[model samples]
Target: MTKLWQQRLQRQQRLMLRYLRLVFNEFFMIAVFILLGGAAYSYAGYIKTLTAPLWWSRPLVLILLLVLLTVGHFATLLQAADSLFLLPQESALKGYLKQAFSHSVPLPWVLLSFVCGFLVPFLEIGGGRSLISIGVLWLSVLILKLGQLWGQVVQLYLPTTQFRSQQVTFYGLSLLSLGLGLYSWPALGFVFSILTASISRWRLQQVQQQHLFQWQLALNQEASRMLQIYRFFNLFTDVPQLQGQIKRRRYLQPLLRWTTGRTTNPFLYLNWRGFLRGTEYSGLYLRLLVIGAIVLLFLQQVWLALVIALVFSYLIGFQLLPFYRSYWDYPQQRLYPQPASRRQQAFLKFLTPLFVGIWLVFSLAAYQLWLAPFGWVIILGVGVFNVAFLKLYVPNWLKRHEN
Candidate 1:
């Protein structure tokens, strides 16, 4: 029974479900979905911004959005090399490569389907709309997936340029038709998806008749090398030491002056280096600049701005942990003499600039309301907590473990 259960657990269907859950964990991806969906809902209200007037804007955003979706879809699949290469045999490679996440052809079609489906609902949600429109949107996705698999199978069997071109042509048409459906005839387009699926199936049958099934091993080293290159690029952007010098980062200049000609803590030095040298950390200040602008834009109300300001300060205070180990080589003799406490004043120092930015944003936001006075007092208290009092207080700081 246990062995049987284990087999079931390892089944492809179960794994696909697991992959779906993992994909949802991506905050940016989820945000993309919600933003697109929400944007569609709010688009009618935002029609004035369109350059081509009202009638043209609806189709324009649909087309642009479809393009974005298709591009994003292909990009996402390319990044999923791990999921694509799970099979061990070289002969079975063709089949595995042609599944739900395949990129070469299917992604564009899928993107189109999703964009069209989303647009259709918003563009034609009422007034005697055929139920087929909603149903056909889903049908189109199934067909696209089928078409992708068929194309891959054909590529494997025929192994010719002509077959590949056919796949590309089909994929392009799927996307174009989806866009058209979104603009005018969603119901007919949905049904058309089913027809597309049948054509894709027929194409697959033709390929199967002509070619033999064979598997190829996924190229592991190629994937690894590609990842390494990406990691190197990430170091330039994600790591702090590689950032270009910035004039606006003059606030950090004092650290260099204070440390010159004097012995300093290497850890402290590394932290400062990361703060100064890293684009991401420096980005915090830039974000602070933007947040103030956004708060005023979104919630012209005074209290909202004050709250956002207070929260922003706290967030900056808390997010400094990642910068603790950015630059420097450790010497054998170097060791921590004092225990690091979570409640240590070190945290407050890192948070001060963020808090200050928040205060400025708050002051600007609530310049007129009586709430400005209350917010000012709170800001003062937060400053004392972050600077004066926290400097003297020691809390539960986590010391590094000796491996």
Candidate 2:
């Protein structure tokens, strides 16, 4: 079981590394750097503008810290096959789970440290805490995270009835500990965190003694967690492991009818159907669109808003390009009466409205931020980029990769 855990971890790591390389390609890396640079610059400017902790600073920081504490889960790495294959070894599963939880700890801890470092200024300058107190506060949250992880470990062996109660206890402890840490003495929070972690450890031991491993529950949780990771990766590149759910968005049938002209072009009709019904393409489109719109809405600067709009617009079209050949593997598609050129033509036609719709949403956000002239500029600028991407970049890309 131990070796099995190690092998699984290594395989998962290698797969993630492979996707990470593709996800962070040259252009995407440049975009990420630009985004980080802009964010840092904006953060510094906003921090400088703060005279005192605004009225909402304490509660806001507390809520954010609480949220951070709630994030992350115990990764068992147990698979469906494990339920049967490893049944004999179930008694030793505690050791394997311990290893899994330990492995999961470092990433979230590193993330927590970075976030705390980022919020340090706000804690000190805004909430009027001493540097040492802020350090104590971080330590407190760190301990609370351990408790949270232990609680998750306990959850795996619990029945649903017990699980709900455990969840209530977990949240209650988290809230009180962090609230004390932020509002009262930092040491009080630290003390409560230690107690919380200790209690959670006791709870895990108790649960292990009283209950058997819940195989179905454990496997289901692992699958759900992995699916989320795959969904994020799916945004950057196709993830075969990610199984998208098909949604019958009946209300969207009208839009499909108008776009495909009732199967005038079978390829176009198929693309439209897949985009609307399959979660993969439509989910990606909506995620980018909403995220881009939110970012643009928040940004007061015209240049920043324009950059965001153009970046998002390009991303949507670029990602959707894969849909052009989505049906090629179907041997029946090769026998379509339509010429090969029509596929490309239909793809562009399918993408045209998508691009236009995304641009319009972004333009509206920019308009709300800075009205009239700037909004018109954003609209025109994004429209031109969309046209250039479709006319210049996409064709060359498809041609270069042509079968």
Candidate 3:
């Protein structure tokens, strides 16, 4: 059983390493360092200005800590076939899960500790926490995280409805304990942590008596985690493993109709519908637009806001190029009456309005920042440039690369 677990772990690690290499390209690594530096500088500046904490500080921190501790699902590395092929090894599966949890718990604690330690200065300067108190709080968070991890394992043994209820109960108790711990009732928090740990153990024992392993549940959980990773990676590069996720999104149907309305060109229709159906493509565009708008709304510097907006516009245009090529995979698309020029036109037509809409959003945010005239010109100019670039330059560039 131990050997089996080790083999699975090594396989997962290899897969992770391959994806990690793809994720940390040189350009991405550089951008990450730049962003991290900017963040650290901003945080230091903000912390120095904090003479004292606001009333909401403790509760906000407590909530954030609770969320960090409670938010993740446990990864048991169990596959769907395990239920059938390894049914006889059910007892060993328990040991495997024990090992999994043992491996998983330390990383979150270490990360949480670093984050808490970093915020220690802020807690001291702003929230008036002593060193000893902070230490106690950190220890309490670690303990609660352990209980939460155990709770996640216990949940796999439960039916769907019961699992959800138990999850909610655990999160609520976690919040209460963290809140009490931070709000002058440290003893109560310790007691709650002990209680949660005890209850989790009791629940585990009870579930073990059934000698049942929920392989399907574990498989789904693991698959969901992988899909999330793939979705993020899909933003930067084509993730062939990614499966398109669609939502009916009845509310957006009208907009979809308006966009694709009675188009004689099949290429335009197919591309528009594909964008609407594929969550990855549409979600990426919307997320970048929102992020750009948020940066424009908050950052007092107009030039910085404009730069971010243009960068996001370029990203949106570039990313959507894949959608243009999506139809190429189907030989039927080749037989369509639409000419290649019309296909390119279709892509431009679909993307132009979307970029313009994003620009309008950013421009509105910029207007609030008192840069309306400059924002309008910058956004409009970029919007036009993006459309033209996507239509003319990108196709030839992609063809060259393909050749």
Candidate 4:
């Protein structure tokens, strides 16, 4: 019986991987995301520049980014199988997640901390204490990752969900506590991280000791759904009519109203309209805002403050590319006697960088109190690309294959 279930689980694992491989292929272009991501983090001068605006900004952004570092370990991989939910045997599902996390959580922190550790040394070159803090920061990242993984297993099989809710607060506090290590005493933060990690392991043991639930399957289906959506959108060359299925969020009607209704091109209008209304783009917006808030939170210098804004400019442009591509059916775009496909491509010319600029201006202003020497460089980059670059290239590229 155990052998049979194990075989079933193995097959399920392969299926999940296939789904994942397909999704990754769609996002191959977006692999460049790491470059922009590193650009913001690699520059501590930027973090310091943004921090001087508010005393709280540094700790808050740093803490939030730390938590992101921790959570990301789990986010990186897909679960092997979810059909365990529909299976006959319960025990296999119960402890499965524990094994998975044990296998997965350490990698993200190790990689991220290594990157962070190197960056910190360069950023805080003169301060020995700050260097020690960076070292502790690297150690604490692994501890936090382990602790959070343990806490999540505890959340799964426990009798009540309330305990899971408490676990979140615990994780938040751990990050908040860890941030202090970056300041006064690096050693103390390291100790606290160890202690918290111990508590998470303890919680997991308590669940095991009590035999509270049967097993842990690949239950985080939401993550799988997100990957699936990204995959499906990759299918159609034009905005697959079905793309609307992903964009329509009735809850966002109030927010959708904020997008200007004046554009004659409905696709252009809807692309902007949908971008604002959907939870997907809100997250992107939220992340930009969060980055700005962090830089402002830790605003200690002039030159570094606007880096968040600059990177966000790139992010906004990259994410909006799909929307720009979908603007073909915009009515104003069809005013001339052009093919429907041609009209759509033309509308994309204007829409692509418009969204990017909106986010860039808002993100940059938070740190704009000083004239960061890099500010004009960013503006010039944005203008040149938005005007001469994207407009010139996208239209021609679309024309090459216009059927």
Candidate 5:
């Protein structure tokens, strides 16, 4: 059983390494370092300017810790076939699960510790918490995280219908532990966390004694984790293994119809419909737009907002280029009487309004930041440049790649 678990762990590591390499290219790594540096600098500046912490500081810190404790789910690396093939080794599987728990919990602990440490300066400066109290808070969070992990394992024994209710109960307990610790009751909070952990372990033992391994549930959970990783990686590179999900989104259908109706070109209509129905392209566009909007709204720096807006515009155009290329996949599309240039025109037409909408969002944010006509002019100028760049460059680039 130990040997089998080691083999599975190694396989998972190799798969993760393969994807991580694709994601952490040279340019991306450099950008990440720069972004981190900028964020740390900005955070320091913000912290220094703080005058005795805001009234909501303690509750916000407590809530963030609660969220961190409760939000993480476990990854056991167990496969669907394990239940069937290893049913005879059910007793030995406990040892494997023990190994899995040890392997899984440490990374989250480290990350959670880093976050707690990051908030320390803020809490000390703003929330008026002492070093001892903050230290106690950190330890309390660590204990609650352990309990949460064990609780997740206990959940595997539960029916799907009861899983969410169990999570809510566990989260409530975690919040209670946090609340007690924040209120200068560290001893009680620590005891409560230990109790939660003990109960979770006891429940797992009870389930193991009465039930067989839940292979399907473990497999589903593992698949969901892998899919999330793949989806994030897909944003940077083409992930052929990535499966697309679709939703009917019936309410949005009218908007699609109206947009497509404005264009008589068959390719334009197809482009609009494909974007509205296809998951990857449409989802990427919206995610980037939302991220850009969030950056503009919060960053308070005109140059930074413009940089983010332009970068997102480029990404949106680049990702959507495949929407046009997807048409060539079908023989019927090739047989259409529309000219080749019409496809380029259709792409530009579809992209223009989308970019314009993004421009408006950024411009509004710029207005908030600068409150000047010059800021508006600068935003409009950048928006025009992005649209012109997309219109002139993307179609040619796609054609070149196609040829």
Candidate 6:
């Protein structure tokens, strides 16, 4: 079982490395650096402004900790065939699960600590804690997270109702533990966390003894988990593992009428309809647009807001570029009367208005950030960017990946 798990883990890591290289390519890394630098600067400036604790500071901190508690899930790495092929070895699979649990902890622990470290300012300003006390609080939360992960693994063996009931109890204990840590004594929280983790360990042993392995449930969970990962990668590039869902979106149907005229290209109709009905392109566009708008609304610096807006607009455009060839798998599409060049023209026609709408929405959100002449300059810059991206970058891209 250990060797089997090692083989699976190595394969998964290789697959992940391939996708990670694609997802974190040059442009994305640069964007991440700029975004992180800007965010850190803004965070520091905001922290300086909080001279005193606000009324909601404690509650907000508690809520953040509560949310953080639920950040990690179990990874079983079990396959569909495992249910049949490994049934004879099921008794020994406990060791495999133990190894899986061990493998999962490091990531969540690092993430928990990283986020908790950022909350130090809030702890000091809001609750007036010393360094030592804050250290204790971090340890307490880390232990609670371990307990949570243990509970997750243990629940895999139990019935649904029992699992849910255990979850509620665990949540209640975590809430009380964190609340006490933040509000009362950090040491008290630490004590409660140790007890919680120990209890979960005990429950895990009980389940392993009493219950049978729930192979189908575990396989479904792993599938769902991998799907989530593939969905994120789908935003950057094509992920064969990820399948997009199509929706009717009846209200959006009226917007497609513009594609009906005799002068319209047939490809335009397909593009518009596909984008409106499918979750892939449409959902990605809306999520980026909404996130960009929110970021622009909050950002006080005009230049920073403009940079962020342009970055998001570029991302939306770049991601949607892949959708241009979305119909290539359909043999019928190849028989269309339109010339090859006309297809490119049709794509440009579809993209032009979309970029314009994005520009308009972003400009409106950043209106407050605009200074007299700089606003016009920013607008022109975005316009020029759209032109360069569509005319220069896109054609080069198509040449490189000629369908």
lDDT of 3 by residue, 1-403 (tens): 7887789889988877777777575134443454445456667888989987767778778878977885555777777787788888777777888888887787788888987887787777777778877787887888888888888888778887877887787777777777777777777787887787777777777877764767787888888877777776666556778867877777777888899888887777777778887787888788767766765565554455556566666666666776767886678755655566777767767876787687678767677645444645556656676767766777786566445
TM for candidate 1 is 0.50
Residue 60 displacement (Å), model 3: 1.6
* Model 5 C-alpha lDDT per residue in residues 243-291, reported as the tens digit of each score: 6777777888898888878667887787777788778877777876776
RMSD of each: 9.1, 2.2, 3.9, 8.0, 3.4, 2.1
Superposed model 2: Cα runs more than 4 Å off: 262-264, 329-336, 368-377
TM-score of 3: 0.81
In model 5, pairs of residues that clash are 53-126
lDDT-better candidate, 3 vs 4: 3
lDDT of 5 at 362: 63
TM-score of each: 0.50, 0.93, 0.81, 0.55, 0.85, 0.93
Off by over 4 Å in 3: 26-39, 159-177, 185-195, 245-266, 301-307, 329-342, 371-393
lDDT of 4 at 340: 57
1-403 in candidate 6: lDDT tens per residue?
Answer: 9999999999889988888898676255566677777777888898888887677877888899889888877888899999999999989999999999998898889998998888898778866777777888899989998899899888779999999999898888888888888778889988998998898999999999999988888899899888888877766666777667998888876788765345456777888889889987888888778877877777766677768777888888988898888765657666755666767777888888888888888888878767744666567767788888889988788667765
User: Which residue pairs clash within candidate 2?
Assistant: none
lDDT of 5 at 316: 61
lDDT pick, better of 4 and 5: 5
Task: Give the worst 10-residue stretch by lDDT in candidate 5.
Answer: 26-35
Q: Which ten residues in a row have the lowest lDDT in candidate 1?
A: 70-79
Model 5 lDDT vs. the true structure?
0.74
Give Cα distance to truth, residue 163, candidate 5, Å.
6.9
